[model samples]
Each structure stands twice: as structure tokens, then as C-alpha cells.
Target: MRRTTRLTAAVLAFLSAPVAQALDTQTGPVRIDRIAAGFTDPWSFGFLPGGGVLVTEKGGRLWYVAGGSARQIDGLPDSVPDGQGGLLDLLIPRDFGRTRQIYLTFSKAQGAGSGTALASGRLDTEAGRIENLRVIFEMTPGSSGGRHFGSRLAEGADGKIYMSIGERGDRPAAQDLSRHNGSIVRLNRDGTVPDDNPFIGDEGAEPAIWSYGHRNPQGMAVDATGQLWVNEHGAQGGDEVNRIRRGANYGWPVIAYGRHYSGQKIGEGTTRPGMEQPEFYWDPSIAPSGMVFHSGSGHAPWRGNAFVGSLKFDYVARLAGDPLREVERISSPETARVRDVREGPAGGLWFLSEDDGALYRMVPE
Candidate 1:
């Protein structure tokens, strides 16, 4: 992989001027700047080791963006671009400098339908291509629909790979241990199941399952304390953020704070025995997506807090406090339909807006 700091003239021109006005919030004044634009349905992005970034579009395009110029990186795996399925989250591991290894999640064709799959490969920036690409894990393909593929990737503190897979629109399937749908799977970097996984010896249970009963958890992050947290979509009004526990059931269709789209009550009531409760929830459903726990000292006031993008509300939610609550709604025209939010390697917060088809950076003014 090669590194380049050369900036294209057009990008240099855009950066020469302020992209947007400074917005004051609880964290003080901050500026949101456009890093790159013209993406077609960008879903996620990751910062490269030396410089630049790798962005994924839902239409199966992987882009190498730097210095305000963008180029498509070849060698992407075969992915189905049907509805919500396509090239999704990207992960640039902590050891990318030495290993040059990166991970990605996409919807793969499984017989008649498609399911979420995880793949790993080496990024050759000099050639603008991926090499030795191989699928590490794939869900059992049965359900068929374009909605709720819940593909998100996170590197756990323990060095394991954590991925979220949605129920594929089959409500009851979230509770089925035999299926990989509607659950978070913990695996080794090479896509093998860890021996200490929650359901290792349980008969009929998929060994990769870390926790089950999630409706469509699109947002996941590990806190400073190494705790895993996930924000899942609710039926109508019950979007929830839960502190993920090993072997715990998160109660999706069974017990939810929201009602069905038809305004009918969901399975059972809100509180149910043997199921976990959300640490925080949104009554009107913000349609949350990518998530990241802010670290380092980029914005002193925002350190150690969590930032979640609201796809429905066109804002980034800052959640803090002991029990966790929304501290502020960071909004700007650049936040329209936020799909992913990640903390930059050096500092500051970066996000992708699906509506604008652009990438942005948020920094303290």
C-alpha cells in the first residue's frame, strides 16, 4: 500500500474556504467541513493508516478518497445491491500499518435470496485494488427481502470482530437461535468463532451468535470501559440503545417499547422477564445508523461521549451521562440523512450523509 499527501487543485480550492458556518452547541463552537462529495449512496467509511480514507457505496462501489479527489478501488467482492443489501460497513483494524488487512460487510447472494457476509483482504493503495479477498463469514440464507440487513462492523476491546446482522424482515426469526439473523456475532479476526462464545455448547444454536433478539441494530460501539453498546430500530416508536451483555436476549419482536407500523401493540408489554432492557430509548424513532464513542482530545468537552447519527432527523445525537441520555442534537445542513459516524484516527468526528452523497468532518471551532 502506498501513501500520498498530494491534494488535487479542486479539493484545495474547496478547503481554502469555510465549508459551513460555525455552529455553537453544548460542546462549544464547532465547524463541519466537506471532505469529499459525489458519492452514490455511501454507507460507511474508514480512515487509512498514513492518510486518506476508504468509502463504501450501497451500489457496490469502494472509493479511495484523499486530498479532495476520489477514485474507485477495484477488487470488491460480489455483492447484491437489492434494496438495503449491498456494500456496507468498512473496518480498518488497529494493526493496519503492519498487516495491511481490512474488513468489510456486504450483502452476498445466497441461492435465491441474499444475506449479510463479512470479508477480509489486503488493500493495495498503489494499485487501487484489493488483493487476496475472501469471505470470512456468511449468514444462513432463507429469508428473502430487501430490508434490515443490519451490517455493522466493530473491533472489540478483546481484539475480536463483532458484527451485527438483522432479522431480514422476518419478525419471529430474531428469536431463533438456529438462524444468524437479528443478532450480534463475535468472531476471531479470521472469521472463526471464538471458543468462549456465549452459545458454544448449546445444541442447535449458531456458535457465532453473541446476543440475539435484535430487530435491526444498525449502530454499535465499544465504550472507554470496553463495554459494547448497540442501538436497534423498533417497530414504530421504540428505538432502543442497549448495553450489550454476553448471552443475553435483547427482546425484539417479543417485547418492544414501540408498536407495529399499524399502531398495534408489540409482543407482550415493555418489561418482560428473562429479557434485557434498553439503557435508553427514542419514543419517535430517530432511525439511528452508524455509531462511535468519541476518544482522544480532539474536542475536550466531547471526550468519552457517544455520537449517533439520526438518519430520520438529520442530526448527530450526543449521548452522555451515567445511565446514558441524549445530551444534544448536533445539526447542520451537512447532517442530512446521516448514515455513518466515525472518530478520525488523529482526532475529530467524521460522517457520511446519504442524502447529500458527501463526507464531512466535525471539529471544535
Candidate 2:
């Protein structure tokens, strides 16, 4: 294969003031080209088994892109696109080849409010539509606002689906196992509670909960060893990356390294007696959105590393080492907000810019 990153001395352009050109940086001299466009706050996407990619826009529309073109896919459930809540992540199941199915997380309309809902649909590529769309999971006690709807999905190595649900702007609910809010939930492919889930036998806890006490984890990626790692947003400055454990409680509102946006201390100090600590945290917050644990050697420099999209900094953080130190902040040609980042289908790196409503691929020059 060709080298993916070339060394250069010029600066990469920002997405907001895009020059439609590539820039050079320390990581490598890279070029960026738009793969698709016409998006309204596109959140996440995944490659299809046969070909093409499926993208979910926050406005509840799903699009299928192939051969440099994109089209809206029908048969989606109506979504409540209020504030930060809307259609979020797209998951391509492990058995996608046998079943042309995809899983989606969105803000579902509940009784008098909205909650995070997980649904699956069959992508009929030939007809450019979605079929057999069904609801698999929904968060309990839907909240009214749209502040924290953490909806990121990743299929684990053990044939189970892992979901990250935010606290729904409800700080206390994250500590309550009775509700699915503010949790890392594990479920079967059919949307049933996995028997191996941590709360399976709990008296009144939600059976789908795998771990609890998460703030607003927008990104989750299973590492090479099948370990689940999540990056969550802190109040003001405490964005965290934690290695997820079964049944473990990651302190959200209770113990956090960040202070409230209004300049107030959050819950006591940073350290609590029983709460799990983050493997890595950003002091001022990178506003982490998407993540991927790079495994293969397709890109020699990224092997065994993790790449995370930073909306605040408009760059991708390349993390390495056990403690997971950010080794480099890889800038893109477009300075627009990087909403999502993933390993590209052709082996380099792919990212979505929320500002420009476009998708770009980064490859070695």
C-alpha cells in the first residue's frame, strides 16, 4: 500500500474557512478530500458489509453514500430533534453480510418527554430505503431537555452490543441503577438484555445496564483485547477517557475533575473513595465526540493507538501508551469542528465535520 502520512511544513486548513486543499503537519503531510456532503449535523457513520457507508444526521434522516453520492434512506422512526438530542450513532452489526441490518441510537419521543432510543433497520441498498425498522431499546423515565443524550454504540467482541447513554442532564440519575440513563448498557443483537450484563439479577435495576455513573460519553471503542473504552464530557474542564469495566461505577456528578460552567465546584473534590478514576482527562476539555482504537498495521504510525475527534480543538487527538497520553493533535485541512473520526474504509482515516456538513478522508500525500 502507499504511505498514508507524508511529512510537511505547511499548516493544515480549518474546515470553517476551507480552501479545499491539504496541509502539512508533524504527524504527516496529509491531503483531505470530501467524500460526501449535504448533511445537517451528521453525527456518526459506518461502512456497509458489501460496500458504501451509512450516515445518520442529527435531524433524524439516514443517508446511504456510495460512489461519491448520497441519498436519503426512508423507513426511519420519527425523532424529536430538540437541542442536543437527535439521531446519533450508526452501528453495523458483525453479521452484516448475512443480514443487511444496522442499529441506530436516537432521541425517541416518550410519554411527555424524550429519551434515548435504540433502533435497528434493514438497509435495502438496491432500493435505497430502510426496511423492517424496529425499536430495540429505550431509556427509562424520559427527561424534558436536550442537554446530555450520550448515544454511542459499539459491538463487543463477545457478540454483544455496548451502548453509552448520558445522564440526560440529570446528574443524580446516573447513580440510580433503576433507570437506563447515564449508563453503559449491554444488550443482545435482538435488543434483548444480555444475560451476562452486570445488572441482570439486580433487584430493581435496569437489566440492560453493564456499567453505571457515566456523565455524557459520546464515544466508545473496543480495543484489540476486546476491552471497552469510553470518553465522556466533563462539566467545564473534565473530559475523561475511561477503560470500562463490568458493573463498575464511574462517578459522574458526584466526583469530577471539572467545575460547573458557572464557576462552581462540582460535587466535592475530584477524588472520591469508591468512584473509578479516568485513564486520561483533558483539563480544558477537547469536547471529544468520536473515537476508534486503531489495531491493524494498515497505517504504520497509527498501529495500537487511539484516535479521538475533538470538537473544541478542531483536531484529532492521537493517543498512545498505557496511561493514554495524547501524543499529537492532528489538524485537518478544514478547521471545521471534527464531530466524528474513524478508520477509513480504504485504510487511512476518515472524519466528519459538523461545521461544513461534509465528510473527508485523510491519506498520506
Candidate 3:
């Protein structure tokens, strides 16, 4: 009972129509189309400017998918595919048409361990390869475990690059400004620190640190209003969606809403005066990943709403309003282990399902 929903014509018609009213859910029946399949642990994907998509698999492979076909793209750096490590996120810059550049986040191998790394490269679709690939940044003093590489990328309205790195399973490091782990780092496109960074002249702090004390922020996006938002995983419960700010410390390991997996209490218990609070939190932990704010006429009713993928619960959570809260949970068989979600160019919602090993597009039916 599934069918393709043609949206190109409707998009054109919607362009000339009056603004549509926002609906709590879809205004009509919807269908999910399988964009491409056969992916193995696909981590992230981005739409190409012309047509098609670039997908990354945690096993260190990149694929160019389009027109129901897929081809591997060459020239990716070696990525360490240990537990919860490997190629993590892909970002297609707003200036891609002019720059032909793309950014990536991955687990870079470090001595006896690994660290979160940020890289940039030029995509040559005709050649099916990435050229001029180079590592722009790597977490300092890499840790000994393969866990907690909080690798997500976003380009701000001011044009600075933002990246998140987890505490590498070391709790105290989140509070240590000397290390890049457990903090969001802001940098120039060429890997240089911005002059106005919060810690430029500070004696024991990394210069690129913008905000500290975050734990495994896997999803990040810059909304239409230029506000940056992130969704991160919690130990057992206490997953959070936070509105990011400069020089702010989001308490980690120090204060949290959830207890440790073994039923032990976590640091100072939730509200610490100086630390910023989450705009929203999940008590049972959805194990969230991938984030996007919807826009455009194709999904007019959903404009400005936030969409996040839930890995543990196998669904996509739609959040909206001033006091952000989950308004809807879009779940189906194809949504299992939702790894990433993106707003398609035409304004349709597309998501990657790790369990299905496929990419799916949601469109009005």
C-alpha cells in the first residue's frame, strides 16, 4: 500500500500560493520513498548542489548516491573504525556551488587511541573523488579509548566552523579547558583559531574552545534564524537538546538530570547556578542523533520546527514552539535506528535508517 508522491509540481504551485497554516502533523497522507540502500553503518549524508547525495559509512567509505544508483567516491583519509568511531558527520556548505567544498568529522587514529578530527575537501563529482582533502583540526592529547568522539559539523552565519568533541570516556577531561575533548571548538575554515575566541590568551585553555563541558554532541544544525542547536546522548537517561551559545559551559559529569547506568547519582544534581540548562531533555534517553530545522513550501506547515533522529527508540522526533517539546514522533518500519535527518532541497524530510541500511524521503502522498 505504498506509492510515490510527486512533489515537484506541488512545490511549483505552492510557490505562488499564500502562506499555509501550520499543522500539528501532516495535512495529508504521506509516503516514504527509499532513496538508496545497501549502506553499512552509514553515518551521515549531504545533498549535492546539482543533484544526488554524498553519504559516509562508519567503515571509512564514501558513496555518491543518485538516480537509484550508488558509486564509491575515492580519496578519503584513513579512519579508525573502532566501537562508536569512524567517519561521523558530513556538511555541505552554503557556498558549495561556488567553493565545491565539503566538510567531514571522523575518528582520527592517535597513538594507542583515537581523537575527533575535522577535515575539508573539494568534491569532483565527474571524477567520483574528493581532492585536496586535509585535516583541519584534531583533538589535543588524544585519549586511550575509542568511545565518545562527539563529531558534528556546522557553519555559522558569521562563517566560522563549529565542531564538537566528546570527553573520550574520561569524565574529568570535560571540565579541563586544556584538552579539546568534551567541548565545542570554533575555527576558521583553514584550521586557524579565530582571533576573538574566548580563550586566546588564557594560560591553560585551548584557543579554539568556544563552549565546554558537553558530552557526546552528535547532532548540530544552524536554524533559519541563525541560531545553532545541538542534541546529545546522555549516560542512561537525560538526553538533551541545547541551544548553543558562546563561552557558555553546559555542565557535564558535574550536574545532570539522569543517574549513572548503575543507579548511582550524578554530580551536583541538575541545576547549577553558573551552568546553562538544556532547552529540552529526554528522561529515558532516545539516544538522539542528527538535527535539522524544517523550511520551505513543500513542508510549509513544519517550517521552523526541529527534527531529530532517535537511535535507541527507532523514530524521528519533531519538536516545536518557544518552550521546545516533542510534538510528534514519526515512527515506521523504515525508521529503525534513525541515524541522520536532513531537510531536502525541495523541503521534504529525508532520514537515514541504520537498521534498514537505507535512506528514505518523506513526502506528501
Best model per lDDT: 1
The residue pairs found clashing in candidate 3 are none
lDDT of 2 at 131: 94
Candidate 1 local lDDT, 140-196, one digit each (tens): 889787989999988999999999999999989999999999999999999999999
TM-scores, all candidates, are 0.96, 0.92, 0.92
- Overall local distance difference test of candidate 3: 0.85
After the best TM-score superposition of candidate 2, give how far the Cα of residue 95 lies from its true spot, in angstroms.
1.4
Instruction: Look at candidate 2 and give me any clashing residue pairs.
Output: 4-364, 6-29, 13-333, 14-334, 14-335, 15-334, 15-335, 15-336
- Candidate 2, run of 10 with poorest lDDT: 1-10
How does model 1 fare in lDDT? 0.90
Task: Give the candidates in order of TM-score, highest first.
Answer: 1, 2, 3
Query: Which regions of candidate 2 are displaced past 4 Å?
Result: 1-22, 333-335
Q: Give the per-residue lDDT of model 3 (tens digit) for 151-207.
A: 989899989999988888898899899999899999998889999999899999999
- Each prediction's total of clashing residue pairs, residues at least 3 apart in sequence or on different chains, is 0, 8, 0
Off by over 4 Å in 1: 1-17
lDDT of 2 at 295: 57
Candidate 2 global lDDT? 0.83
Would you list the rank order by lDDT, best first? Answer: 1, 3, 2
